[model samples]
Target: MENSDVVIGVIFLSQTIFGFLGNSFLVYHYLMLYFVGCKLKFTDWILQHLIVANFLTLLCKGIPHTVSAFGLKDFLDDIGCKLIFYLHRIGRGVSISSTCFLSVFQAITISPKSSRWTQLKVKSPSYIASCVYMSWVLSFIVNIAFPMYMTARWYNRNITRLRVFEFCSSVQHDKTSDIVNAVFISIPDVLLVVLMLWSSGYMVCILYRHKQRMKHIHRSNFSFKSSAEFRATKIILLLVSTFVFFYTISCILQINMSLTHNPNSLWVNMASIVAACFPAVSPFLVISRSLCSACAGNRIS
Candidate 1:
């Protein structure tokens, strides 16, 4: 156990514990909202699924990296490696898709009545559950090849062309196969990220126009600052920015890893750490928004 590895393990442990607790709190809060007969919005359903996916992502990726970082050997068998990697990939895909959906939904929700998105804004809520389910199904279908390529790390054999992880090793396919697989795996992610960015831009334009319109009517900066619209916009941008920043870093690392025959363990650990950041941080952001909304509702009532 090198000192650096130990430090990485400690970091992973902390992220896993904090992310689990934060997501668990969110899960409990939503369950209570349902049980208390509170009317949940369509976006609430998407958020519920997103939190679950985040927990899944943290658990599958974090625990293994932590165990491996501490110099644990043979912790996972072949079946375990395949199952964990497959599930982690699915969780990641769902997180990406759900975030895109949420952003697009919100953009539509806030669009002016005469805008082109008005029809979608009216009809979008009803399909939230179906959209979430389809994302899971598509993710599963797309990543089904992962388990076939993954196996437990072989200690005795000297594998020359394998990309070894902490507990698992992926077989390096031939060039044509590798290109095809990469394309299939990355297409959905690329599409989702594009949609998310587009919707985020749309939201920003709407917010800017809204602020300009409000300035003439209110004539008070404090009133605009205190408004729910401003608060919600701020939260959305923060969430989207956090997701994109960490996600982009992880993607770059992943690309670098793919281009190398033997990926560096340090690079792997760094990628995992960045990958876990959004999931770990996002729940606290949502919880803050929830608390704020609750306070505002109380004052209103």
Candidate 2:
């Protein structure tokens, strides 16, 4: 393999390993908490599902890309291509949906009891469960065309114009079909982005109000629950902002690639790396936040 290929392989492999392990740790930790009879909070339930989605995304997307980068041409057959891409799409959808739900849930949770959002607080668990189920179903339905449109291809060093990965290529679709698929894939993402932005904004307003109120209260009268909620909201906000930043960059690069018909360009690779980085880094962020919160609680006590 070329030196560039080696470098790409190394980067892909590192991302895959780190992301897989981090997400796996989260899943294991949460499952253990459940088995030990600790009650899982609504946020924990959302996180557990999010970790699973991230883990699957890293595995399904990263492994194939890594193998291809390492010069394993035609490693995946047509069926393998379909399955991997389908799962990756599903995982991506679930990740977006779950994050949106988490943000909205927290927004409602922290809203004033007299606010209109308070009603959602009581039904939040049921809504979250239903949302999760619908996310899976929607993702599956949207990606069902993947297998029918994908085919495995052997890599040819002499061919310079083919921009797809060495292992698989998507069959060209009719213009109408292309438009329909694009719309279908984009609707959920657009809706999720809108929801995330709205929820985050609402939460920020709530936090600001709470902080103003806190200024009037004596330090000795501060509530630990409020402090914890503030910290958790901040973390979730950071997470959502990070996701939006990365997802936006990735989407722009992908759009550029599609327009230029150069999916093998370095920009495409960079997009993939940025997309993978969120899942890889998120688990560590959660773990660190949890540790810091625990330490703070102990110190306060």
Candidate 3:
């Protein structure tokens, strides 16, 4: 058990290091844009919020756990467990908000003259601040008591073998409290999924409309505006699609574990890794926009 955990720990440790370096470069680059007061023309102020949210997601999930893995220390005392889990939950919530907001922003940006949101489009930036604020507040409200529901247990004392981080036990509270926790957790998940699905469908619709329009127009070449927007849309779609895919699977595994009672160490660890991978991989995937742009137009077809 120790041997297997050690091997996996080493691998995740590497992921932790690489994720940090990449996100660090991204954070620095975006900060330069913010500091220089660069007019973010093609995009809007929301990109700043997205970048910050991604950075937090990566930092919270990747850094401390890496340290814990390398030290071969669970370090999940009561306070420690609560703090780590709470912060990571916040990061996770913020990520969902940022991604959903990105989708809506893109949809608004590309809305046609006949669209209902056209008036909202006129003052898009004005509406964006409020939406992002609401996203944060909504996420915070839903997840505020998450830490209270989780308890840290010494792995050997509670189970056959030790695992990374202290094991977490859940509510022995009243049925009402348990129901509340489940509903609170589930509400955001459902809402985010709906937001992402709607945004994705909306983006696909716009892309198809653009394609149909292109067929009639002079295909002289790609205009930079059209090219940039299309590529950005593709990248955002890919990120959100990946998020939804893995997120759905992880949620299923969690539910399965909940219902079935016995989740082996292997299954438990694998589920943890699967859930963890989405947030870690998301930043790099988003940043890869630059590399793929040269071929994005070709791929878009």
| Top candidate by TM-score | 1
| Candidate number with the higher lDDT (1 or 3) | 1
lDDT, candidates in the order shown: 0.83, 0.79, 0.66
Q: Residues 104-138, candidate 3, lDDT per residue (tens digit)? A: 77788777878898887878766767878887787
lDDT of 2 by residue, 1-301 (tens): 8988888789989999989887888777766665655655678778877887898789886787788888886888767878887888888899999889989888988999999877788898898889988998998998887667666665323334344655676666555776787787898899999999999999999999998998999999998877887888898898899889889988888777655543663665676687788888888888878822232222211
What is the lDDT for 26 in model 3? 62
- Decide which is better by TM-score, 2 or 3: 2
Best by lDDT: 1
lDDT of 1 by residue, 257-285 (tens): 88888778888899899989889988998
Point out the worst 10-residue segment of candidate 2 by lDDT. Answer: 292-301
lDDT of 3 at 70: 56
RMSD (CA, Å), each prediction: 2.9, 3.7, 5.4
The lDDT ranking, best first, is 1, 2, 3
TM-score of 3: 0.82
Question: What's the CA error at residue 249 for candidate 1, in Å?
Answer: 0.4
The TM-score that candidate 2 achieves is 0.91
Q: Name every residue pair that clashes in candidate 2.
A: none
* Least well predicted 10-residue stretch by lDDT in candidate 1: 292-301
